[model samples]
Target chain A: MTATNSFFHPAFFYIALAMVLPFIRGRFYYWRWLLLVPSVVAIISVISMDHGTYMVIPWLGHDLILGRVDRLSIVFAHVFAIMSLIGFIYGFHLKEKAHHIAATLYVGGSFGCVFAGDYLTLFVFWELMSMASVFLVWLRRNPVSTRAGFRYFFFHAVGGLLLLAGLLYRYYAVGTFAFTAVDPSNAQFYDYLIMAGFCVNTATIPLHAWLSDAYPEATVAGAVFMCAFTTKTAVYVLARGFSGFYILAVMGTLTAIYGVLYASIENNARRILSYHIISQVGYMVAGIGIGTLMTVNGAVAHAYAHILYKGLLFMGAGCLLYAAGTANLDKLGGLVGRIPLVMIGYMVGAVSISGMPFFNGFISKTMTIAGAAHAHYTWLAIGLEVAAVGTFLSVGIKLPYFAFWSKPIYKGELRPIPINMYIAMGIASGLCILQGVYPNVLYNLLPYPAEAMKYHPYTAWHLVQSFMLLSFTGLGFYFMRTVIAPHPGRNLDFDVLYRLIVNTFAFIICKPLAWMDNIWTNVYRIFGMRGLLGLGTGTKWFDLKGIDLVVDGTAYTVGDIGGVSAKAQTGRLQDYLAWTVIVALCVFAIVWWL
Target chain B: MRNWLGDWLEKTRIKHAKIWMGVFITIMAALVIFNLFIRPHHVEFGYDAYCGFWAVFGLGVCLLMVFVMKKIVQPFLAGPEDSYDSNE
Candidate 1:
């Protein structure tokens, strides 16, 4: 129970701090084994019997309470730790200290945020997480990345401001900053404000546009880090703060549907995966929105499962980017033959995201669907199911088809991927399979007190349904294969409207304003009317022709000033005394005049 | 047996391939109605009959969607790898 005896405690502080050690003082080993420390501690913590929140240090301004290591936080923390390790391994050969530092800080910040018992402590670390992660996106060293990182920061900054405002209001009202339940139905204004802050990071609907736009632009490794934290932490916040906010269900369902549609049209392999991040989070948000213990548990479970597979998928795409110099699906055909390992890794990740049987996504997604069905929100469940199908279509079928099987646009130029990259992906692929096959590994960590989800991967009906669906889809693909010419091109969506149309509108408005100013200046010149300038410069205004002449005449006379100057110029000590006496007499005389 | 099963699968796959979207849409619509009307009222739609029904229906819908996308939709939407980028 003591922090010293418990290895699973925020012992992550040293480990996370150590993750930054490599980047702080650039040495070779910083990037290698330092990544594993957080993961090791996270695993130990998950298995440990620590309950109730405990601060890392009670006295410091930075009080990180490793409070309440229950089922939910454990699940999230566990996955985050594993993801940090996998991501580190994936970028093992990356020599940049910035990349390592950003990853460590980002993951470490998330860890601190999740374990904090108080909202004040969480906000401090939450902003840290945002500040730390932006460097990852900027590491791409491209204009696109620079712009994307700014947009990413802009949204998060707004979210942080909203959260702080809410916290301030709550602190004023309740006189306590500890994380506690607040009912949305009769919520203090602060609660709604805080929830809005949480939603920005959660990528809830209208606010979600930044995630898809920004994530794909990060450096290959950067995207992996982006995929791992942020939104999932918001899901954590949702679980903790606004557990049963019903509107979240609507938001989640719409996000799921929207993600799939946009993903369907996307050409970049990484972009497709990024879209699915929103889609999967939608399921989690919806589950949390349902408010049932089982459903909220499902959201927690899904967030845990999603981090792993989504990270894996991003890693696979990164591997493709590393080897072939492109992740554009059109240009990346028959890569399966070249980088079979990466292809396999991508397939595992794709299957997992697709909710294929014996995959991590299947176990997690079914729980959400079941929770909805249990709640008798059949329509929401149906939307989830439809979105699930869309998920498979956009990622499972489309990614593999274009990347591995489609006719090679890069037919002769394929290259082998790096060994470290393959090994990293291999580890992730194994974990995905293992978690899918035996989901109890993941299920045990849910915030719920005990394990309740029983996944039946094989029933007669289940197999039949799965087979019928897969086989028919396969049939459809082959029949229409001739018609579907696989090629890569940009398909504009909501982000494009902002980037192109809205920007153009700003330009147009500014141009007219500029022209109007020009016209106004011309009119002034035409009339010879420079009123302000004329007044100041003695053209024909108050300074030269009006009140200034009278005011100056009344204020002073040159003769009065000359008399004082002559007295001050006498240098002899006696003369100086006499001059001083005269000045003193003048001072008394002026006082009498006043 | 493997060959026979494979042959049957190929035959079935090809025959059902073109209309998979239509079939999927129909099943999804039916499931929606089932969940909305029959299940909500606690009508005996069978023992948790629709419980995993969506999964089955989803599989069909998913496969058909990919098919329609890859075959019909993609051709119009997808262009040459760098077709739009004239300079490239």
Candidate 2:
């Protein structure tokens, strides 16, 4: 299908659905059926795609490609569609129409980004994703989520501006807006700026604090959607544009290690999972940075797997929040007996995320690690393995152990969990296992050919090695359980710097500016207004006294002259002869004198 | 359904939980030993080919991260849950 001939891009279905959602009134009975839009769109994405651009339109003298359905874009679109369906299913019980609307727009935005063929199209969707997702955070309507949502919006806005600036610069420099891999060797400054923007969204290091700080604060179902789209889309963009950039490898390693280190000490269950997103995304970033065919394939594969398992993890966390009214590990325990199914669902997600055998993470994570090792980046490979251990320790063991297995600290009543949440989790968990057992299900979708990858996750050594690592990590956790116990506290992160900068900006810039504005207001109100008033009074006085007097005096003199002429003309003929004789005598005297 | 599963789980927790942990540890040890007998494929990175390198690395890293984060980083970084509250 050509750009003009194809039906509307799959994203339009979501946009159209979001628009009509508000009008459907009184008890959203049709929501379940309506929620299948993304899945239908996914089917459309598969059947309609012919591995070329569709829905191209000339926008601002540029060809804005809305549907770029190539291998790379299609894989991401497929996962995005699946995740959106799952997210909607998870949030099926929500009566708030706004949640569904925002979610649809957010998911639609992500689809748009994945399929965007040009930078302009990508930027439009990127912003839409950012704007739509913030409502998810704010919909919680608490002071924390509201504040976090603002910060999230501000950060993403800045990222969007950077992307826009870079795109504009690139357009001016190269005169094209095609989103292609940047050549680092001959790259201009705009390319780096664009990469920085991607890095911010990727949640790399200093830019990453938003993920941990905000996601834990999102609504239960909102967090699940938040976890899947933002960072993965960043990975997609990075893989597409900034592949083979050496800086990413170094930064990605640091991000992975840093994220895990923080996840170890975090008290909140959702926050721990949020930190793991960073750590997991780090692996994908590193894979893209390596830029080998295997590594790129691995990165894409990891993104696919990460979305499934991470969404499952968030769903599990959301379940805890729904039932217990809190996700604090310090408050939760002994739920293994109470919510056994949730625990089972959670453990499946936890093990899958920890890269256990016969799980999705096992296949995808190993591909990235093996690719790194194969590329001869030995230290990077080792660093990633160490991060994997930390992943198992914190996410696999600590979070679940404290939330479900530890001694009960919470003495509150537990709420009944919604069935739809379980359905969503079950579906995710099944997919995780399916992808793990049958790697080809995921491998066939990789941008690179499955055969050319030359990697296998089911080998005996691979299984043995992974088992040894995970088991030993479990042993370590068992030994150090007391030391790693959760406490009722928050650990400082890069958000502190963010808060400090914003606060300082308010104090130094905003405060003084406000003070100056006050002074200016006082000057304008008191002095400037008084002066103008006085000047107006003086001008009025001058007009009345000086100019009016002169006019009045002239009028008086004219009246006197008119009175004299009236007296001279009292008698008609006699007066006229006398005046004529007087005039003639005066004229004769003047003539004689001259 | 809940009661039956909970009862079974409670029984398992009381009687067979420690045994399962022991079995898990034994299996890990057996894997380590089995790894020693079987020569793994050597890649460009040779250290990982060692029999129990991953086990040691995983264990050491996990312990170090826990102790360091708990004892050192937590004290400095940890604050009240509402430390960022606007009222404060």
Candidate 3:
């Protein structure tokens, strides 16, 4: 079946077009109504769909295909669609049309990637996503943000290029660009390369630097949008393609540990959350790497839970950034008194991400721990438990405490957060609670069978242990509060190596090189070889007094005499004509002798 | 003494009674609601290990709640806007 039917696949096409609608439509109220089109389509797409590729060709030459609305793609697409609606509501008061378009295109592009069944289609959507999301970071227009956006785009562009290469190679190797199953038995260089492509965006280890660098630079709403999609999609890809790769277990564990360490020391609120994103996704990735039926199920479940809790945390941080104009730990305090709703929102998110018993994260994270233990990865299980404690320390206690409970470092009264922000946050908070209470709702969305996965986060003992671990950590936080100081500033992360040393070196080199080049050109015009060369060849050496006296007379005479005495060049114009004659005679004699 | 006092006040200390109280209530509400509403389904692996994990966790949480209430919460109340922050 050809995948093109414009009328049927209205969701993908309309959302794609809706990206540009903001620029043309102009009115603020109109865009809200326009946002409804995709939300409706998302619901429609989920409820009533047939499996083969769906293509739309309303406009000729635009071979648009909204392919594969299967359960796997549907889960990602549905969350992305819902996220866009929530983001729209949260950012309803934004005035910039450019940002609105950028945001819409970014979300729409992610959805497009979700529905793409072929590598060609995925590549197109991937590059568009790379281009579109940069605007979210660039919207701030501060020097810090501008630099961050450039770095973000640089990494994304590199990822997209790698994806293109992998896709082309896969197509060459298998003779098709279609999204078919990759057999673990036939895992080749292309498969590994494709997985690497996914890892770059997954914020996988060395590639993980961009998340902390760019996220804090984005506008609050932009950061909220960012928290939902990119890395989660990478997890989705891993769950699909490289499920049995054992190295991923190591990769995921490192990512988790690396994230916790950075987050522990970081002060910028959004950056802290960004590092936590890596940490949490590490759990998901490790689950995928473990690759048992239960573990894969856990990976999908974690993705679903992560989207909600992480988005909630970002939104809370967004709220703080929105009202107080800063998200530094030291700069903010006592905000809970003023904006009680925001604090409630933040704490809900914190608990959910911390995997405390009865929170959404607890439900998902437990599966990975059990899966790891069941697989006899006892050390890994213990590591995850320790990481869980760190999670609560950093987010559960630290975020709300500093932003809401900490002493007010600055005096300010914020106007009540807009009603729409409340509505968005409320929905997130409700989902966090609901999903925690009823895991079956999210479990049902898993591509793998939930029953096949055996794990429990909430038996009496599991509750006691998690509580105990968190308790000890809490004691550590309180007793060590004086030593664990949170300075009111951003701590540099992975990119600092590049930003400080490498970039400074480039600056140190390039600045002087350019200056030297500039000053030398000026100096060259006055004297030196360049100045000499620039003096027209027609100018005789005698015409210049210094050259004439210095070169032609006493200087040349003495130099020539010295040269002849040294038998330099034989001094023979036939050996000074006669000695030249004698030398020529000697040359002839030598020739005769020979 | 005065210098030490100034330094102490300058640190990033947490404040707010109502907020942490709300946090405590929310957490309890979540625990109770999930415990009651979501019935735990039994799998082949018994809840023995699971029970142990939660039991220990609960005891620790109870104990820590006391310390948090005393050390962190009692001292940091939301009074006037500047209660927690002393700006020079």
Top-TM-score structure, candidate number:
2
TM-score of each prediction: 0.75, 0.87, 0.73
Off by over 4 Å in 1: A1-31, A56-68, A449-458, A479-487, A496-594, B1-88
Would you list the C-alpha lDDT of every candidate in the order shown? Answer: 0.69, 0.82, 0.67
Put down candidate 2 lDDT per residue, A519-580, tens digits, no spaces: 64455456656558776566556645755555444443333222223232224323433454
- Tens-place lDDT per residue, model 1, A279-354, is 8999999998888877887888789888888988998888878778788876777555456667668889888887
Candidate 2 docking category?
acceptable
Worst 10 residues of 2 chain A by lDDT: A560-569
The most accurate candidate by DockQ is: 2
Better of 2 and 3 by TM-score: 2
Cα miss at A383, model 2 (Å)? 0.9
Give residue A385's lDDT in candidate 3 (0 to 100): 63
